[model samples]
Target: MARNKFQTLTEQMFYILLALQSPCCGVDCMERVRQMTQGRITLGPGTLYTLLASFEEAGLIAQTALEGRRRIYAMTPAGREMLQGEYARLKAMTADYAAYYREEEKQ
Candidate 1:
């Protein structure tokens, strides 16, 4: 089977999708991402808009509405599934790290 290009998402992509759990415009999405990460992740307009365009192109997100020039976006069903898969992957990685360290501690 061919691997999905987006099988793994960059941290920016992950958070951008996460912020779109509800419909929001580009600026709002950027703010939400920063707030969600407690300012740990700050996305500039260039990066955020670029990823949004890419996500929309990939069918991972949809533009739900437009307020003037701003476009409100929401995650599509495909986007949610992709996000869940990424979450599982992250969990598995953490589990592997823990398992490895646990055996080391036992030795």
Candidate 2:
């Protein structure tokens, strides 16, 4: 059986979509991710471009502008819902882990 495409987003995909919350070109995406992650996440041009194409194809993101060779992307309604769902899932995971550790401490 095939897995769902949007089951989860990679770190790169998450940050890319996040950067797209505002209008920004490809180069701006790299900078934004760097600032947001404090240089922990480095986005290479190849990965960024590939993910952009895939996201656009999947209707997760739409091109809002084109400046020279750069394309500015933003989240679509679908993309926003996807992000929210992913955030919820992540939160649940952390909550569960924290609960387990708290229980362990009481023993």
Off by over 4 Å in 1: 1-3
The list of candidate 2 runs beyond 4 A from truth reads: 1-3
Estimate the overall C-alpha local distance difference test score of candidate 1. 0.91
Candidate 2 lDDT, tens digit per residue, 2-87? Answer: 11676798888888888888888889889999999999999999999998888888888899988888778988888888888888
Q: Which lDDT values do the candidates have, in the order given? A: 0.91, 0.87
Predicted candidate 1 versus true structure: per-residue lDDT over 1-107, tens digit per residue: 11276879999999999999999999999899989999999999999888988899898999999999999999999999999999999999999999999999999
lDDT of 1 at 97: 100
Top candidate on lDDT is: 1
